[model samples]
Target: MARFIVRAIFAALGLWLASRVVPGVRVDDTGSLILAAVLLGLVNAVVRPVVFLLTFPVTLLTLGLFLLVVNAAMIGLVALLLSGFHVDGLLAGIVAAIITGFTSWVAGMVIGDAKRD
Candidate 1:
């Protein structure tokens, strides 16, 4: 409920940061940015695990590097689904994914720590 919304906001902040820093990542507007965040969260939650499992062997072969590609694919998928969100190419998507994931992780840590205290 409230936690979900907070997570969504953090995700949106990540997306917004990605758009600012990643050259080929563009978020059309604030509303679209928020929608993209929510959709990205859903994509990560539902599709990521299946993709991770399917690619486990490759992931193992790559020594966990393939996980980055998986993350990029998730970002690319979100771009395909959202008109206002655009990732120019796989490389750009990968970079954007890294930025977004880092932001989300930091936010989660901060928020989670606050909750425990």
Candidate 2:
């Protein structure tokens, strides 16, 4: 639970960063940013795997590049579901995905899985 909260915070940070750097990715306020982060996490966890499975052939054909589209779609899905968080198009969503993914990667590195004490 604690770890989840931390990761969510990092995800919000990523979204904030994306809003600043990506032209079409707009997060209206801190509240929207936080909700979007949690929603994005849920979308990634639940929807991404199913979408990946469905697009496996295309993913293979594209030599893993299609994964970017998948990520963008997930971001776009969040935008569709959340009013205050908006992604203008596929390109902007893709950029937001990249920024968020990099932010999560660094966060994971810094907060590796902990062993039971």
Candidate 3:
């Protein structure tokens, strides 16, 4: 539970970065941004696997490049589901996803390690 909450916070930070860096992505408010982050995490956890499995053949055909499209689609789906989050188009979604993913990766690298106490 604590780990899940931590991940949600990291995801929210990613969304915040996305809103700042990606032009066509917007979060109406702090609350909306947090909600979108949690929703995005849930969507990735639950829906992403199914989508990946269903698209496995194409994903293989593309030599894994299709995963980016899948990630963008997941981001777009989150935008559609949430009231205050908006992604202007596929390109925006892709850009937002990349920004969010990069931010999350950096944050994980910094935060995942425990300090000696």
Candidate 4:
């Protein structure tokens, strides 16, 4: 429970960074940013695996590059669900997704290392 909350916070941090780095991604406020992060985490947990399975063929054919599209779609879906979260287009979504993923990965690594020390 606490772990999940921590991860959500890290995810929110990633989204905040994305909003700063990506020109076409906008998060209206802190509340909306956190909500968007939680919603994104839920969508990724529940929906992403299914979508990944369904698109396995294309993903394989693309040598895993199509996962970026999958990530972008997930971000776009979050934007649709939350009025305060906006993704201007697929390109912007892709860029935002990449940035968020990178930031979140770094956060995870830092947190994981902290636990070990």
TM-scores, all candidates, are 0.92, 0.94, 0.88, 0.90
Poorest stretch of ten by lDDT in candidate 2: 108-117
Please give the distance, in angstroms, between residue 97's alpha carbon in candidate 4 and its true position after superposition. Answer: 0.9
Q: What C-alpha RMSD separates each model from the true structure?
A: 2.1, 1.7, 3.3, 2.6
Sort order, lDDT high to low = 2, 1, 4, 3
Indicate the worst ten consecutive residues by lDDT in candidate 1.
108-117
| Model 3: CA > 4 A from native | 110-117
lDDT of 1 by residue, 6-111 (tens): 8789889988898998899999999899999899889999999999999999999999998889999999999999999999998898888898888888878867
- The residue-by-residue lDDT of candidate 4 on 3-111, one tens digit each, is 5677788888878888898899999998999999999999999999999999999999999999999999999999999999999999999998888888778767766
Runs in model 2 with CA error above 4 Å?
114-117
* Tens-digit lDDT track of model 3 for 8-105: 88888888888898899999999999899899889999999999999999999999988889999999999999989999998888888888888667
Clashing pairs in 2: none
Candidate 1 has which clashing residue pairs, if any? none
TM-score of model 1 (CA atoms): 0.92
| Backbone Cα, N, C clashes tallied per candidate | 0, 0, 0, 0
- Return the top candidate by TM-score: 2
**What is the Cα-based TM-score of model 3?**
0.88
Clashing pairs in 3: none
